[model samples]
Target chain A: MDADLHPERGMFLHRLNPVAKLLVFSCFILAATLYLDVAVPLTFLVLAWLMGWLGARISPFALLRRLSPVLAAAVGLTVFNTLFYGGPREHLILTLGPLSIWREGLQIGGSIGLRILCVASYSVLYMWTTEPSRLVASLMQQARMPYRLAYAVLAAYRFLPILQRELGHIQAAQQVRSAHRRQRGSWLRRITHYGIPLLVSGIRQAERLAIAMDARGFGALPTRTHYVRTHMRPLDYIFTATGLAACALVLFALGELGLLRSFLAGVAESLAGAPQ
Target chain B: MAQERLDLGLARWTTREIIVMAVISVALGLIFMAYGVLYLALVPLLGQVGIMLLLGFYYLTGILVPYIVRRPGAALVSSFLAAFTELLAGSPFGIAAVWAGLAQGAGAEVAFALRGWRDYRLPVLMGAAVLSGVFGYVYEYFLLSYAVLEPTVQLGLFLVRIPSAIVLAGWLGKVLGDGLARTGVLRGLAITRSAS
Candidate 1:
């Protein structure tokens, strides 16, 4: 919600076409998916983070702060994989209950966690740098998406903040009414008491918004003048092409290194190579 | 004078109503997002907990939002709002949230759409649940499950997920909605009885 986190100017990444970025990002994900190598994925993740710092001009610490939840989840996943999803590798790390903690499982889990982190980081970078309106515009202009559908999606995006504000107001009122009631009730009871009014109000608001849009001539025109236009600059093409090339090269290198086969074999080989 | 009063009462900014609803939606969204994060985080510790938790959140949103708003897109908006909250909260699921939100929203919307935008009875709510559950199953099968397991196991898991979403999440949502209506908060909204 902070405007500073998504600044209006001076971010190089923001200037590129959103559709291009989306394509490039998808390529990266696809390339990452083709192989199971942690190195390639980790490298990509690092590169993304660096791009966020250099291209978006965001502080690394601020970016990391935003990414803390993802990091925690990744760590949790790694731990879980290490303990429970033991692979067929002969290298045993530990044992618990019926599950044998193998080196391969841990390695595979760590690789998976890294892959997720990489993908997520790149996506976060895209979203943080690009304004939703510009992104929608790029989609329409560059990708030739139907204007009507694009507009509808944009309208929905625009309404999101208003809806958030409305939802906040609803919760406060419910808390006040329930203040006199004992707080010792079960979680289910409390949720029921509070959830009803909010739901009713949200529906009412949506209805009003629908009416308001209709009244204002939204969706009335099949074609409308562009309030915002997105043009694909030379840099956009360069960025897209370069990013895709890099992603392809990484995939090729990963395959050549035999890490791809190891990755596809599941947790078995990953754990075997973990300690080394 | 009476006409003027009626217009004013109906059309005026009722800050109290707006504030109350806004707060509830945001709070519920935050809770759902948190649960989603926990579910994803605990996937290794608890197999399939992430899917179940996500389904539970969707079910709750579908039931609660429609019960209160009693209008078109309420369920859809609620489902998406919950997803948005998760994204804002920095979900580990990343951009998958976008697709998941779309699918979940559509599921809840289909139920309301089927009733011709008129009914909000228990059966209607159940219909919404079933629709949402089925959608969730299809979504997981293609998007998440396919990458991890065999076709048979994936299909079986999908079956498990659907009923769990319907019975656990869907039923709970309906019960919660009804209970709240009984408390008189939903006095303004029209209430319909179940045909059964």
Candidate 2:
């Protein structure tokens, strides 16, 4: 799955254990969720983008292009919140005919939108740097996932592209066979027709592979030796420390500005004051 | 005594079963990517509540895999893997996708567990799908700040999701599983033994 279209380029994040990266990035995402203010998550989003550019060696243009879909989602969310917001309209931001944007709605929407983007940036950065095999290896060694399940994931990961190609083939075959029919019917029918063939071929190939693997004594023992190790170096700890410090720094700055507000608290307040 | 023995029997996972579940997840992961695209396109026209109509797509792996594999953890493992696959496939939601997967999978697993890992009837499958919908909704309620929305809109979102779960994940999963069973590809699996 990590076809590495944009190769790691021997960047800093690439050297850390994927698990360590997962841990650090998760903190940033968790922080993104807790705060209701736009600046906190926006800061995190900028920091994530900087990490992608400086540490991960991802080009700025490429990052934007790759994240274009997220941009759309953020924009959609902002627009939805700005328009349908049922909050007090005391601080109106705009009035484009029947559609009016209020300050409260805009703040809430912008915060959530930036929050989504911030989360996606960290996730994309992690996936871009980490290799699938190393991730599975790390999960097994560090996370203590069973070797059997981990190997199954690796095998299935290897089959993804093959299954995609088979799906294309099935769609083509079904289209050719049904060219005579006038009505294509509902989307459900189309899925079942194509889904059955794709699943059958996939299961058959999986069974054959499973048999081959078992014959080789794939899971003969409870524990297996790792061919590739994903060790957490001292640098990984330092990197995690840096990420935590950055999060704390942002929160402290926001707190000093009196802008740090818990999103859950705000929601609870609104619900409490809402009409029954 | 019989129940304890049955629990022991169902707990073990064979290599074939694990591989098959993984394969099914990868396929469904691809389908999920398609649904993500369709979802973004429709969100503008349908708004938030209408988009719940597609939430069922997310639960397919959870419901279908358990019904076919009839294993205790099949739903949870398969759905989690499917979500992981989607994340790897560049899902915009990223890590949250896996969390949602875990939540949905656990909800579906509860339904199967209630049946003692035995029944795969349509009703049981539908029950599983509905539970998955409910679980997913609770997650989104906090994550997306659904609580801030109007009570009516929230209710509408919850109401629309149930039918979507029923038709898309539950009914559709059973249909696909039955079709695959007829093709004889599922010859060695538990589904075949139970059906015969």
Candidate 3:
């Protein structure tokens, strides 16, 4: 899956251990969830974008273009919250028959929207920086994940493009066999029929892979030597420290803005609510 | 060794089972990419009112992996890997996609664990799917801000999505599992005597 993306060479993120990058990404998202206020998350979003621009070596304009679909989701969810959340009807900004949008609804919607933008960037950046082989290798060397599982995962990661190609072949075969009836059915038919042939081919290939790996003495040892050692270097620690300090700074800022409990409670309460 | 391997109670993942997990996840990951296009088109059109309509497409790896692999933690790895696949394939949901995967994986993992990882029957598997739906639903509830909606609207969304889960991930997952089983594709791999 990391086959297509080539991170700019010698960039700070590309040099960081894949595990460090993943940890930073995970911590960023987890911390971003702490606030219901827009500023905190929106700040995080801008910070993430800046990290992409400055550290990951991505162009800001191109990054935004790539993230536009995610931004669209933020817009969709925000619109939904504004219209249907329906808080204190008197604060209504607009009304269409039974549908109403309130000021509070907009605020709440915007917070979620900002969170969406803030959260999605973590994955984008992580995927951008970390190669899949490096990720699995890091998991093995740093986290002490069993090499059996790690190499198996690497092998599986290589299966993605093959599966995609096989899927195209299956559809083409089906098209030749049933050209007239193909377009008439639901996507369910197309997907379901497509899944079987792909799966069948997939299982066959998997069995062969398992045998090949075993024959080559894969997973024979509890641990194995690494050709590319993945460890946290000084720069990785700097990246991690910078991420931690940034998180602390955001929380303190949220506290200083005095929008602590009520901000998050509103969201938690909304989620915790169920039909009486 | 074969007998021990066949026992689902043994949480140990063999090379074969790992490959199976990876294979299914990669294939489904491609499907997820396809599904993402359909979802992005529909989400804006339906807005919040139909957000749950896509519920079925989510949480499937949670169901499919455990049934096929019959290992403890298989569901968790499957869902997570599948989510990772979607993320790699450029899912717009991004990190929340991983969040949903983690939550659903944990949920389905619990369901299978309750059966001691020994049960892959249709009922047991479908039950796991529904549980995964419940977990996936809760993640979306906050992540998508359904929590901020009116109580009635929230209930309406929740009610519709659970059944949609029943149809899409639950029923549809079972259909695929059974189809694969009947072809003798999974006969020696899974301990179960009959795919049906």
Q: For each candidate, what's the DockQ?
A: 0.13, 0.40, 0.44
For residues B54-131, what per-residue lDDT tens digits would candidate 2 score against the true structure? 878789999889888888888888889898887777776768888899999989999999989888999999999999
Provide interface RMSD per model, one decimal: 12.4, 6.2, 5.8
* Best model per lDDT: 2
- List ranges where model 1 is wrong by over 4 Å: A1-8, A96-98, A139-186, A262-276, B1-31, B37-55, B59-92, B102-164, B172-196
Tens digit of lDDT per residue, candidate 1, span A60-128?
677677778778766865665455443355588887777676766666567666766776776677678
Stronger candidate by lDDT (1 vs 2): 2
lDDT of 2 by residue, A36-78 (tens): 7788888888888888899878976777777788888888887
**DockQ winner among the candidates?**
3
lDDT score, residue B120, model 3? 78
Question: What ranking of all candidate models by lDDT puts the best one first?
Answer: 2, 3, 1
lDDT of 1 by residue, B30-145 (tens): 66666666666666665543355345555666666666556666666556555654544445454556556667768878888888767776667777877777776666543321
Give all candidate RMSDs, comma-separated. Answer: 8.8, 4.5, 4.5
Candidate 1 vs 3: which has more DockQ? 3
Q: lDDT values of the candidates?
A: 0.60, 0.81, 0.73
Number of clashes found in candidate 3 = 0
Q: Measured with DockQ on alpha carbons, how good is candidate 3?
A: 0.44
Which stretches in model 3 have alpha-carbon errors above 4 Å? Answer: A1-8, A86-90, A179-188, A259-263, A267-276, B1-11, B90-92, B191-196
